[model samples]
Target: MAARKKWYSQGLRFSCTGCGYCCSGRPGYVYVNDEEIAQISQYLGLETAEFLSRFTRETHRERSLNERPNGDCVFLDPISRSCRIYPLRPRQCRTFPFWNSNLRRPRDWEDVCRTCPGCGKGPVFSYETIEELRRVIDL
Candidate 1:
């Protein structure tokens, strides 16, 4: 059977402009698993336990990166507005704008593009690529 066409079936453009808009001004989860915690800890030269204590918080029995009082991600540098642990960032962080919540419908994608400058600004991601990314983190 042929698959139904989605609003973004033609593909979507996205290239992180690094404005940090997505990283701040909103309180949301950047959920990380045990393996991600370990990698981020090693990248920062901190012990796993120390990293978890200082950078993560538990809510609803799941672990996620901490956010600043004003709602910026803890790893978001106040000055540069870039992630401190970009390379080892969790899978959730790696998949941005491609999240299911954002791609579920055209309206959702429109909402995301409003805040995320990266959306509609760069390479065109085919539906196949977008679907693959959406599967990476069940967001």
Candidate 2:
């Protein structure tokens, strides 16, 4: 009989080297759920309504954080590629290669992996960590 395959058994790995490449330039759309919105708004010392109005845009009934004119995320500090609201960043940012349906495809990761220095090699996190990330993002 064949051994069962784990979710991430493909041996994919990554560690944020702080390159900020992911946060730079035009960051793609980042979805924000109600809980994430509340957490981030509270972290910024604002009411949810105010934060939503000032920092977010509505699209087809979903909410997304506003991006800069250049398309980078508003919370992304261009110079540092670091999140201004790191403590309150949405679960999407925290999960990276483990979030949503994107990373499920190995081929899809290649384009991103090619540009990120930390893609193919980095510190190995335990399976527990990956599972935790999944939980945080509600994946």
Candidate 3:
């Protein structure tokens, strides 16, 4: 049988406005793998162990970036409202609004659009691209 088409099969537009909405005002995990951790550590000029100790916390046997007391991502600059480590941000951070959770239904995408200003702006991402990104992380 043929596969079912998704609500966003045509595509969706998104371009990060650097608004920081996805990085703050909520308690969530920004998971990082070993390679990402290493890259971020080197980018910050810190040893891997030091970076892990200072910037990450273990939860459910996985490593996640630490959040500020108010639930803002640690890398989010409160004054600038931009990511401090954008160059080497984790896969989870890089795949915003394309996660499985957000693409599961039209309603879910709408909710994402409400919270993320970039959701319906900029270049259109094809279904193939969305599926590739959605497979990167479950979210």
Give lDDT per model, in order. 0.90, 0.76, 0.92
Q: What residue runs in model 3 are displaced by over 4 Å at the alpha carbon?
A: none
Q: Estimate the overall C-alpha local distance difference test score of candidate 2.
A: 0.76
Which 10-residue window of candidate 2 scores lowest in summed lDDT?
99-108
Better of 1 and 2 by lDDT: 1
After superposition of all CA atoms, the RMSD between model 2 and the true structure is: 2.8
Ranking by lDDT: 3, 1, 2
The residue-by-residue lDDT of candidate 2 on 18-120, one tens digit each, is: 7767666665677799998998998889999999999999876578889988878888888877888888777677787666454566665676788878876
Q: Is candidate 1 or candidate 3 better by lDDT?
A: 3
TM-score of predicted model 3?
A: 0.96
How well does each candidate superpose onto the true structure, as a TM-score? 0.96, 0.79, 0.96
Candidate 2 lDDT for residue 4: 65
Candidate 1 TM-score, true structure as reference? 0.96
**Candidate 2 residue-wise lDDT at 6:** 58
* Candidate 1, position 6, lDDT: 89
* Per-residue C-alpha lDDT of model 3 across residues 1-139, encoded as one tens digit per residue: 9988888999999999989999999898999999999999999999999999999999995899999999999999989989999988899888998998998888999999998899999999999999999999888
